[model samples]
Structures are given as structure tokens and as C-alpha cells.
Target chain A: MESSSNRLFSARDLIGFAVLIAIIFVVLPIALDGFRLNLFGKYLTYAFVAVGLVLCWGMGGILSLGQGVFFGLGGYCMAMFLKLEASTPENTSIQSTPGIPDFMDWNQLTALPAWWEPFNSLFITLIAVILVPVVFAFIIGVAMFRRRVGGVYFAIITQAFAAILTILIIGQQGFTGGVNGITDLRTLKGWDIRSEEAKEILYFVNGGLLIVCLVIAQYVRKSKLGRLLIAMRDQEDRVRFSGYDVASFKIFIFCLGAAFAAVGGAMFTLQVGFMSPTLVGIVPSIEMVIFCAVGGRLSILGAVYGALLVNWAKTSLSESFPELWLLGLGGLFIAVVMVFPNGLAGVYAEHVEPRLMALLGKSKAAAPDSAANETPAE
Target chain B: MFSDYTMNELGAIFAMQGFAGLILFSVFVLMALGLAIIFGQMGVINMAHGEFMILGAYVTYLTSNLFADYLPSVFGLYFFVAMILAFIASGALGLFVEWVMIRHLYKRPLDTLLATWGLSLILQQVYRSVFGAREVGVSIPDWMMGSLPMTDMIEVPINGIFVMVLATGISLAVYFMMYRSSWGLQVRAISQNRMMADAVGINTAWTDRLTFGIGCGVAGVAGSAFTMIGSTGPTAGQLYIVDTFLVVVFGGAASLLGTIASAFSISQAQSIMEFFLSGSMAKVLTLLTVVGILMIRPQGLFTLKLRK
Candidate 1:
């Protein structure tokens, strides 16, 4: 694993990471205004989910369409804490139950639900933001993978989970914020999130967190486990025959994806100032998959760019000609799958990177090395 | 919950709920039949299935309006014409889609899912642009309107019975076509062993196109049937996509009988639960149960054993 990790990180990998860091941390902030920067921040949050998909769907070949379920769980956990902080007795004096959330009051509840009580403490909420989704993913992963469910069956079942979670959230309106979601989230422990300064700060926080996660994702990809995941993906029965507990590896990768998505969801709440059932549903989950696909399913860095590019396109296209956005996205999906199955990363690796490497004789040695390793993936 | 009602009232409630369940079952069966054929036979996901259904529904809508405006005296006969037209319109589009898109994705099942999802999104936008965002309803003929009163307290809508009959007729027709015809034999042969079927002089590609077309045409008919019980909208098809998929998967993807049986059980479970709980909760429970069962039995309820 160490030798493989060392071999995986060429000077090219460092250059890629450096460029990504500079763009997110330096270039984007300097170029865009606060509003657009904030929107990019929101998009970056989704990049978290895409990066996770690279690990789970791209590397491991386990596509969980219900990543939104984990994202929603994490976001809601954070939002609950924020909501509780905002609903201080003095803040909600107009309500019948002053200390409780306005929705709970509107629904005629005098006391907070036991489940929500834990979220009042920010530490517990933070832990829960990551823990809850990972736990849920563990249960789902254990059940399905242990029973040898993979491919289309696994995809459909995860989608069904997304459907179930959405309905549950919408149905349990009082507790989960229903269709409108938890709104009016003003402060995070006396620091107002609504301010411009806070938004910029949260953007940096999001960018920084993303880099850290990217490092972790790259580490996983370079690890023996990563190669094992690829092996299992290409030939599951062969991997299982060679003394590997395939289901355990699958469960671990799935839980890891859920944790990443959960963190992203929490950051989404912080930066966006609200979390809703809308983010936790089937549509958003599938959209997240497209982000991974468009970026280059197999490339971690490409996924981040993919998320930003897709969301940016979505915001711009839907803003001008709302009807055309769906058409465009649909067309993009077809183009991505039919024409460029490897996505942006694949294009870069095949076309752009090779040309660049040929221009710079230094890259010639590493090119053949990576090309040998990626033959199976091709 | 039972203690709240008197014995007679409880009996009436059960009967009423059971009848409602039957209507839901008809809908599931109608939708799932087409899905089972496409998914089970050809191994294409066809996420745009609901859109195809909506195509049939829009055709029905157009046919109904045409009858009211140009053939008022023969309006009662417009439905049969609409069903036929819906079938043709949807089948043609399905065939076109198969040729252009689905043919390219035979080796990659997961990519097919994503590609078809893209197709569904495009179809949804097309429908939205053409039909507008609002839900539209087709007017039923005079004979299809009103209800049949079985008892003083338990009355069933005539349209519910009509949908049931339509579902049954289509199911039987599909069964006969798939089991009792040479085309069905060809389809079965292709599904069982494509290379052998090709070597034996069956045109595999043509059969695939027709099978896809017929599957989508059945969905069109199902959508036509849907206009009886619910309104039509561009995204209405999305609401039922997961449920229909579950029905097909739960029934054992390749077996038509399994599809019907799974639809029956799911719809009944959902409708009965709806009587005692909120609609969304009932739906959540039903879907959760199906998913849980599927995790344990991933092959579905009725699997046909095949060589690897």
C-alpha cells in the first residue's frame, strides 16, 4: 500500500492539487463578488458528495443513488441545532411555546421532541451530523452487500431508500421541518450567519474542508484498499475467490461516502442558512450522481470541478431560460454516457494530459506508468 | 382503530377500502406490466416509461377534445380510438428511442439507467413545454361516468370498474401475445440466448425494437387508463416511476405473473394502510417493506433460473 501510494502520487498529482487549491481559495474569491462566491460555496458543498461518489461509485463500483438521504440527515442534524439556538425563549416570545421551534409551536407541541434534544448542544449535533448518516449507510450497506446485491439491483434499492426517506421527512412535518424545511435560521451561537462577513468566512471554511477531504480521497485511491476496490469492481467473484470479504469492503466504502456526503450537507446548511427536504429527495440525489459523471466519475479533482460546473450551468441556464435547463441537463446526461463514458477526467487523461506531457518530456515516464495501471478501467 | 366503529360500519369501511385497493391494484398492474416486459425481457430500464404513459394520456386528452368538437354524436366511441392512437404514438416513439439510444447501451446496464433517466428528463421537459405545467384531465364518456351501488353504504365508481376491466383485458392480451404467439417464442428465445436465437435465423435486433415498442405501447395504454382515475401532468409519471419499478422488481423482473402478484400485494398493503394512517406514511411503510424484503431476496419473488 505504501509503495503503491508513493507510485500513485506523481509530480502531476501535486500540480493538479495545487491548481485546485489556488482556484478555489485564491482565484475564485478574487474574481467573483460575495454573492456569486457564496453560490460557488454552496456548489462546493455538493462537490463533497461528488468526491464521495468517486470513491463509492467510481472506484468501488457501488452506486448508491440515495446519497441524498445521508446528506439530508447530516444537514437536518445541523439545522436542528441552529434552529434551537435561534429559538431562544426571548427570540420566540410571540409563540405559544416560547423556547421550542416555531413549527413545533404552530403544530401545538409544548415540549421539544426527545430526538431533537441532543441537537441543542452543538458538539452533539456536529458528531451527529457525521455519525447519523454513516450509521444509516452502515445498516443499508450491511444488509444489501452481505446478501450479494450489486449493480442495477443495488442502485434501485438505494433509490427506493431515497424515496422512503423523502416521504418520511415530508410526512413527519413537525419534527423534520416538512416540505418548507427549517427556515429563519439566523445565528450560530451569537455569530449571525446572515452577514456578508460570515458568508465569506464560511466559504473559506468550506474550501478548506474540501481540500482536506480531497487529500483523504486521494489517499484512499492510492491505497491497497483502493486497488482492491477496483479489482472487486472489475471482477467481484474473482476478488471474493481470492480470500477477500467483499461485503465488508463495500460497507466501509459506503459508510465513508455517507460520512463525506453528511459533512457536505452540514456545510450546506451553514452556508445556505437553511436545510430542507428538497435537498434530501430523489431529484437531488440523482443530480449529485450526474455531477460525478460529468466531472469524470473516476477522478476526485474532476468531481469537484464537475459539481461546480454543473451547478453553475444549472443556476445560469435555469435563471435565463428555465425550460432549457432540463433539456440541457438531459442532453448532457446522454452526451456524457454515450459519447464520453469516462467524463471530464477521462477526456483530460486521454487528450489534454497526453499532449501536455508530450510537450514536457518530464511527463513521458509517468504517462506510460499510469496508462498501464488504467487499462482495466478503460 | 376498529373499536371506534360499529360492526356494520366497520364491515362497510373494509368493503369500501378494499374496493379502493382494487382500483390502486389495477393501476399498479397496468404500469408494471409494461415495465416487466421491457425490463424483464430486454434488460433496459426505460426510466422514461412514465413519459410514454403520459404520451398515451395526452393522446387520450386530444382524442376526447376532438370528439367533443367534431364527433359529438360518436363521443362514446372516442375512447377506443384514443387507446389505439395512444398505442401507435407511444410505440413509434419507443421504437425511435430504441434505435437511436438504447441500442448503444446493451452492454452497460447501469449506463442504460442513467441514459434513460436523461431521456425521461428530456421527455418531461418536452411534455411540460407542449402541455403546459398544469395537470390536465380527460373527460370520460357518459357510459363511463357515475357509480354502481352494491349496498346502501358501499358504492364503487364506474370508472374504477372500467380501469379494472381495461387492466385485465390488457394483461390477458399481453399474456396471449407473449405466450401463445410465435413472436413471443422469438422474444423468449432471444432473451434466453441471443446468439443461439440469431444463429437459428431470428432477427434479434428487429425483435428487440418491436419488444421495446410494444412494452412502451402498453405503458401508453396504462397512461390512457390513468386518465380515468387521476389527472395527467408532465411530471405525474415521475411520481409513480419508483412504485412501478418496485412492482416489477418485487414480482421477479422476468415473470409477468410475479409482476401482477407484486403489484396486487403492494397496492393492497398501501391502500389498506392509507385507511388508518396518513397517505405519505402509508407509502413510506409500503416502500420500506418492499426494500427490506428485496435486500433479503434480491432476485425478487419469481426468478427464472438461468446459466451464468
Candidate 2:
């Protein structure tokens, strides 16, 4: 196992990771064309969301179907900021717009609500991007976890939360952007979103953020809590018996995952400069799962990989077949589960763990009872 | 005439809203029943449950198309055949899945979730390939489509009543099967104690597959019924997954009584709220209320002895 650890840390795996990224970057540009690369930025943002899901779902035994809640939370937070800044009397953006936003006009609002105040500041917007979702998750997680709501019940409840949130946003229309969602921003920090450079920068920024997330998740995976999370996944009862308050741990991870998703959602809105009720709805929330599923939800790398692949396939297929994408994406998922069940990350983990184990010469000590601790997880 | 008109308007709205809730209740019941069988009988968290329901819906869509083109004169009657075929198709797919994959992974309940999720994606894509990506409107017949007039002012949708009756009858039949029949006894025994059931000479494998088949089949029935009122698309089942799961879990994993109670409560609450408030606010309030209540009572309406 010492050799295994050494082997795992070998330069080859590092090279492999880089090579994969390089291939993705090169191939996406070539195959997708410039216009398609514009769409790839959105896929990258979704990949960011997939990472959040991988944590709560792939690692922890929590099946969070409402990740879109955090994603939308982040997007709406950013949109609030843009709307505040863009609402100046001199800015044509605010001209002809009634009371507040057009939706609010319809809702018969006479003035901007006080809650809309902090949104004008980029600083406050950044703080809100993380704070709101964390606060919401904290409250909800505390409530649900204290009572020990879990399994299919927990997943369903969270999903309902996502569905209801979208409806609420749409219904409020004025403050929340309603069905039209927040759109047509002039610029993000003086860079035209419609410009090619801005789009490319958005892509690189998303890609880089994904990498940072991967490293942080990796650290977490190797930490004490990570192993504890695995234990919780395998046997929460046993873990609880071990004297750890299981609920707190779940709450901690859920909050962390929400933050990650919020970051992604915030960046996504910055890139696209739009937010819509559909983005927060139940359907897109489930689509996040497909990204995790095909990418191998258990692996950080798999989460991003799944996101990029599924979204890429969707864009390409939707363009060519216009309608064949769903069939293809669905079939691909079944095939991956059937043939590549480990997911891309699972496949990576298999080779990386063994070789790294051999290189580090740790396998020699990992002899008889090692298998007992190697819990096979979902 | 003035009193009659006023009374008629109120009656019509009430009837529409009331039956809409009933239809919603039926959909929840069918979805939750399939999920409960798998989760309760096999103890596997089959997250792909919604996909199965979607499968049934697509089958209904095809059946609708087939009838429209080939059996025009008897188009309405084709619905019966479609329902049966959807049941068989989804059930058969379930059986194939059990044999090919799920059988090996039941021990890992949560792992099966991810695998089945992948399987769901595969199924959805297959549907998209065969059908198209855009929503498919499963056309109902004239008799099924029209309304039944109760008073000059109040009209009840024929389809809504038809669905409610169909759901009630199917649910009763399933209930009888699970509680009254020999096979049902075998299923309960296995779910209660799989090792012990096998020790007692019950064919555990056969039971697992059959239960899974029936679960998926019921989902198909639910899916087909959903097409009557809901949108039909490659990913249509995604809409009901949460509601269905909520009903099953809130009801209690293996308890049919729990499902019905949960379904009735949630649907009625949602529908009534929609009548009073905007649709979105109603949904938000309903969910928030469910979550709030769940925060206190996690085992849901009925407490099952998952006292492991």
C-alpha cells in the first residue's frame, strides 16, 4: 500500500489529467466551431454544478435532486446586482420600465422594494451569492436533519422545494423576473457578454474554477471528514454509534455543496447575463443528475466530465438531429451505466489507486483484511 | 335565471378544481405504488422509478398514434390496449434490467440509485430517439375528451371522472393482490425477511423480478393516465418524480395506507391552495408546509417499523 500511495502520486496521473483537459479544450473548439464554443461556456457552468452534486450525492448518501435551487439562488443573486446597477435614471435600460422591472410593473409595484437595495453593489452581490443559499440550506438542513428525514423522502422533499421555488419566482414576476427571467444586461463589469473575448474568458474562468473545485474536493476527500462521510454513506447507523452527530456532518456537507453550486450559478449568470424561472425549475434540477450520473457522481473529475459530455452531446445532437438529442443522451446514459458503470471517474480511480498503491509500495502491507475497509459505494 | 347562472358558475369552478385534485391524486397514487413495491419489497432505492413512468407514457403516445392511424373507427378503444401494452413494455424492461444489472447491485441500495439514474437517462434518450424531443401530445378521443354536464351552469370533465375511477379500481386491484393473494403473501414475506423467505422455499429471485415488473407496470399505467391531462415529452416523467417519491416516503416505505393518505393530503392541499392563490404561490406554500411538517414528523403520516 506504501507503493500504492507512491504509484497514485506518480507523474503519469498528473500528465493524464492535463492531457484530458488539453484534449477537451482542443476538440471543443475544433468540433464545435466558434459559435458552438459560446454554448460550451454554459456547459462549463453546469459542470460546476455537477461538482456540488458529486459531493452530497456521490460521496455522501444524500440524493439532492434540488441542486438547481442553489444554482438559481446564485444566478438570481447576480441578476439582482446587475439590475440594481443598470437601473440608473440615465441608463436606457431603466427607461420606459415601470416602477421597477417590467414584471413588477405588471404586479402594480410603485417603487423598488427595500430588499432590492444591496443588489446594486458588486461587493454585496458577491456576499449574497454565497450567503443566501447557505442560510437557506442551513435552516432547511437543520429542520430536516434534526428529525432524521432521509432516503427517498429527503430527496423528494428537496425536489418539491426546487419546484416550488421556481413557481414562486415566476409568480412574483416583478422582483424575481417571473417567466421572462432577468435578461438583456448591457455588460458584466464593462466587458460585453456578446463579445468573443468575453465569452472565451468566461469559458476559461469556468474551467479554472472547476479545477479549483476539484482540488478543494480532493482535499476534502482525503480529510478525516471524507472518510467519515464514506462511513456515513456505508452505514449511518454504525457511524452514529461511533459517537459522531450524523446530522451535523450532513448539514456541513450540504452547506458546502450549496456554496459550490451558488458559485457556479453566479458565474453562469455573469457569463450569459440572464436568469429565468426555467433555470430554477424541477426539470433542469434533474438534468444536473444526468451530468453527475454520466460523469461518475462519485468522482470530482467525473462530475465535471459528465457535465461537459452530456451538455456537449445535447448541443451537438440538438443542432444536427434537432430532436434526436434526448434519445441519444438517454441511450448514452444507459450504455454508460451498463458498460462504464464506474463512470469516467470510476475508471480513473481504478487505475490511479492501484498504480499509485504499487508505486508507493503500500500494497505489501495492505494484505489480508484490507478489503474489509474498501467499501464499495454508490 | 339569474340565480341559476350564478350558482352554475361557482359549481363549474368548484367541480373543475375538485376533479383536478382527484386526477392529481390518482397520478400520485399510481407512481407511489410502483415505487413502494420496489423500495419496500426489494429494499432498493430505485431512483429510476420516474423513468419507468415516462416509459409508460411514451408507450401510450405510440398507442395513441397507432390508433389514430390504423384503428380510427375504434380509436377510443385503443386506449385499453395501450394501457395493457404500456404495462407489459415497461414491466418487461424492468425484468430485463433486473436480470442484466439490478440483480447484482441490490445489496448496494444507494449505488443502485446512481446506476438506475444512468439507466433512466438511457431510457429517456431511447424515447427521444424513437419519438422526438418536442413534447408529444397523446391525443385522446372525443368521448374521453368531452365533459359531462351536471347542471346548466356546472359541467364536470368526463376525463377527470374517468381517471379517478380508473385509478381507484386499479389501486383496489393492486391492494387485493398485495394483501389477499398467494403471490402477494410471497412478496410480503420476502420483503419482511428475504433470507427467511428463501429458507421457507419462496423463490426470492422470481419474487423480486415480478415485484419489480409490477412496480414498473403500475408506473406505466400512471404515465399513460398522466398523458390525459399532462404534457407528453421525452422527459415528462421528471415532473412527477418528486410528488411520487414524497407520497411514498411520507406514507411509509412499504405501507399502502400511508401512500393513499399522503397522496390525498398533498393533492388536496395543493389544489385548494391553487384555487385561493396564484398557481405558483400555491405550490410554494404547499411544499413549504410539507417541509415544515416533515421537519417535525420525519417518518411521515404513518410510522412503519424500519426499526433496524
Candidate 3:
């Protein structure tokens, strides 16, 4: 059990599997049109959220219903930066632009307010994606976790935070872009987003980021910190007996998840070139949790798979029969929850084992779950 | 017309805003009470709670439509009947969900949030399919419409008085049901310790269903009543969910009195500020204040701890 050299997957095998994933994602842009690419871009942003849920929820057992708060925080930060960059240097009276965020016109606000001056720099905006959510999360997490808030209690608190944030953003029409939110950005760093090269670059970036996150997560899943996290999730009191600072671990994982969510937000803003309060709210936040649950929260790739699949279904369902979309979504969750308590990945682990990673061959000598009962801290 | 009131008019302004605030507080209390019952006693987060309220609103709408067709002269009385019907309809659904879905997942509260959230979306779409997308305005009966005669400067709306009275009466009835009744005793016992109650031969399953139904039934009544102040639409429930959640949570999970107090404070702050500031600004101020207060008292306004 303690052999250092014997590992689940060798470095070469991981690289090969990564290559196959790269090929599929890298080829997708060429295979699909602009509209489809845009839709996938939205999915990628959602996957950003899934990545975080994998840690905070799957591993830490923190059923945070409002990852959207972090997602929105990041999105708003990027949106603010994008808006600044898009603004003319001369402060020309930006004419009655029809789709130019409704808040700007509703408040009859003239020339960007003084508070918005700093977001003008793209670099700062980028930095804010990480900083704002981290700070907010740390403050919130520390206060709550220190009190040993876990389970549904923790979830409801986070939801309330998201709700308050949403209401504040919606009500503060001028500053936060209100209900309509920020929109109508022309470019990012002078690169035409419409160009094929730019689209491919975005795709590669999203895909690469996803894999890098996967690797980091893998290491964390196996490390002592990971075991400690799982231990914390199962029984906090016991972990305390084992001499671990449960509060710090909770905060660390929570912050790591938030940071990943922000990165997703940044990439999403770059793709959509806009952000709205609706992007991060109670509704979307709950949806992210559902995605993780449905995909099997304990598995990293399962979360990614769930995010992609659920988003695809949402898009297609809403577009196909707008009337039945909600019903279909609800029914799907019911079926998933009722049928697969461990989620879709659990099904694969049970039945379609050899088929999933077929590239590695049917009877691979070693596989993860090297210890069958041992669950990864996803 | 919208500027701050003159010194002479300030008393009248405060009186009006205060009355409006009271009504608003009543609505919050009603909404939060139902949620508190479900969450506190049952340990379940019913995300579709707003949908149950919508069902109540629809019932009221249907009752209005029925009265208009059958006996237009007796239309005002339809509200009472409609509220009962909505209570039954939504409660029946709550019972069904508790028995079928929620019962199995009793130990997993977070999962219930997602499952119910999905349920809410489904119910909303169903309402949209049936009610149509446009906001449906319920006709306030002649007696209920317009304002009550008061001093020249202070004219309180008839509906505001109606809501306040109804909220107080219903909340009292609910309190009686929860605190003073045998059924409520069983519910309290179950909430306190499920295994102990089960050992004591309480009909735990039935209690769970009935408690959930009552919570939803209260939500139904709230929805029916909300048709007076707010618009009736498929998505109307979404409007109150945030505010209701805030009130319930700020009041703490275990205390009903806290719910009432929290509602009173939040609503009063909102309405008073709205008189001077814009609607949005008032909301921002209220939220900032609540967040600050919650940061201090994470257990909420009235933290009633028994088990711990």
C-alpha cells in the first residue's frame, strides 16, 4: 500500500490521453459554425463553474448553491474592464447606442463614474477576477467556517449571500449595470473576436486551461491535503481530533474553487464579450451544483462531462421546444437523482469501464480506484 | 411630486410609509413563516416554495374568473374561497412531493435544493404554458379597490389594511397551529429528534407530509394575498423568493418570532428609505444593513438553540 514507485497512471499514458482530448476540442471549431462556437463558449464558461463545484462541493462537501456569486464577481470584473477598454479615450458622448447597457441610460449617468476609473485598465480587471472573489470568499468563508457551519446550513447562507448580491446589483442600477447588466463590448486587446484564428485560440485556451486544472486537481486528490479534506467532509470533529485546522482547509478549497470559477468567468467574458448579473445568481448557482451532482461530484472528469452535457441539453432543449424546456430539465434531474445516486460517472465506473478509456486498451494493468472503495476527493 | 416631503407633510408621509411598511412586513412574515416551517421543522430547503405560492395566485385568478362568470355581485367573497382552494391545491402537491420524493432524501438537504429548484423551473414553465407569458392582473373587487378615507393628507389604501389584518390573523392562526396544538407538538418533537420521536411512536411519515403541506398551504395563502400588491405571472414567484429567504434566514431557522421581527424591521427600513430615495437605492441600503448585521450575528436575530 505504501509503495512510492507504483502509480495509477504513468506520465506517458496521461500525456497520450491528454493528446486525444486536445485533438477533439481543437478540431471542434473547424467542424462547427460561429453560432455553435458561441454556444460552446457559453458551455465553457459554465464548465469554469463545474471545475470549482468539483472541489468545494464534490470534495469539501460544501453544497454551495451560489458559486454564481463568484462567477458573477469574476464576470462583472471582466465586464467592467471590457467596458472601460471599449470606451473612447476622448470621452466622446457615446451616442444613443440602442443596446448599450440600459443602466447607463436609466441612471442618466454621464461619462463613466469616478469609481469605474480603475476598471479601465484591462490588466487590473483581469487581476480583479481573482482578487475580488477571493477576498469576498475568504471573508465569507472565514466568518462562516470558523463557526463550523456545514451541510444545509452552509448552503443556505451562501445562497442568501448570492441573493443579496443579486438584489444589490439589480437595484444599484448605475454602478453594477443593474438587471440588464454590461454588454456591447467591441473588442478585447484589439483582437477581432470574429476572426477564425481568435476563435481557435479561445478554444485552445479553454481546453488547455481545463486540462491544467484537471492535473492540479489530480495531484490535490491524491495528496495528504486531499485526504485531510475528505476526512474533514466526512466528520469535522474527528479531523479536529487528528489535529487539522479544518477552517483553513475549508477556506483554501473554497478559495481555490472560486479562483477557478473566476478564470472561467474571464474566459467566458472574452468569448461572449458581455456579462450580466443573471450570469451569477441563485438560479445559475443552483444549476451548477446540479451539474456536479448529475455528473457524479466525486469524479473530476465527471464534473466536466456533466457540465458539458447538461449545458448542451439546456441549449438544445430551450431552442427546440421552449415550452417544454423547463419540464424536460426537471424531469431529467428527477430521473438522474432517482436512478443514479452516485451520478452518471458512477454508472460508467460500474458498467462501461473498459469502453470509456479504450485508447489505453481493455486490460490496462493499473487504473485509478487502485483501491476500489477509496473515492477521490473530486 | 417625488421629492422629500415638507416639514408639515412629514408626519403624514411617515404614517403612509409606515402603514405600507407594515403591509410589506406582513407579506414577508407570511412568506417566511411557510418557508420556516418547511426548512426548520422538516430540515428541507423547498426551492419550489415560490411555485407553490404561484399556484395559490393562480387559484385566486381562477376564482375571480369563475365568480365573474357565475355571480358577479358576490365576487369579493370569491377571494376567501379562492385562497382555501389554493391552500388545498398547493398543500396537496406538497404532501405528494414530501411523501414521494422528499421523504427518501430526508438526510440529504442540499440535494433537495437542486431537485426542488428543478421542480420550480418545471412548475414555472407549466404556469407559463397555461397562464401565458403576459402578467395577468387580478381585478380587485369594488370594496377592495382604492384607498380608505383618512385625514386629508394621509390616505391609506384599503388593500393595505386588508393585507395587514389578514397577515396578522393568519400568522396568529399559524402560531396557534404550531405551538398550541397537538399536531404542532408532534411536529416540534420530530424536528427536535427524529429517532426519539419515532421511538416514542409518533407517526413520523404522516407528520412529515402534513407539516410540509401546512408550510406550503401557508405559502399558498401568501401567494393568493400577494396578487393584491404584485403582478400575477408565471415568474411572479421569483420576485418574492429572495426577500422571503432573507427574512426567514435573518430571523434564524428555529424562531418564528424572529421571522416576524426581521420582516418588520426589513420592510420598515425599505419603505421609509424608499420615500426619500429611489426604489433601488432603498433596496441597496436595506441589503447593506442586513449583511452588516448578519456578519455580526451569524446565528441571526433570534438564535434559538435546543439540540446543540
DockQ scores for all predicted structures: 0.71, 0.45, 0.43
DockQ of 2: 0.45
lDDT of 1 at A273: 94
Ordered by TM-score, highest first, the candidates read 1, 3, 2
Best by lDDT: 1
lDDT tens string, model 3, A185-260? 6668777665666766776788778777777776677677777777877777899998889999999889888888
Q: Where in model 3 is the C-alpha error above 4 Å?
A: A1-20, A23-27, A90-111, A354-378, B1-5
Please write out the lDDT profile of model 2 over residues A150-178, one tens digit for every residue. 76566767787888888788788877878
lDDT computed for candidate 1:
0.91
lDDT, candidate 1, B260-283, per-residue tens = 999999999998999999999999
The TM-score between candidate 3 and the true structure equals 0.92
Which scores higher on DockQ, 1 or 3? 1
Q: Could you tell me which 10 consecutive residues in candidate 1 chain B have the lowest summed lDDT? A: B104-113
TM-score of each: 0.98, 0.84, 0.92
Deviation in angstroms for B19 in model 1? Answer: 0.6
Model 1 chain A lDDT-worst window of ten: A369-378
Best candidate, TM-score-wise? 1
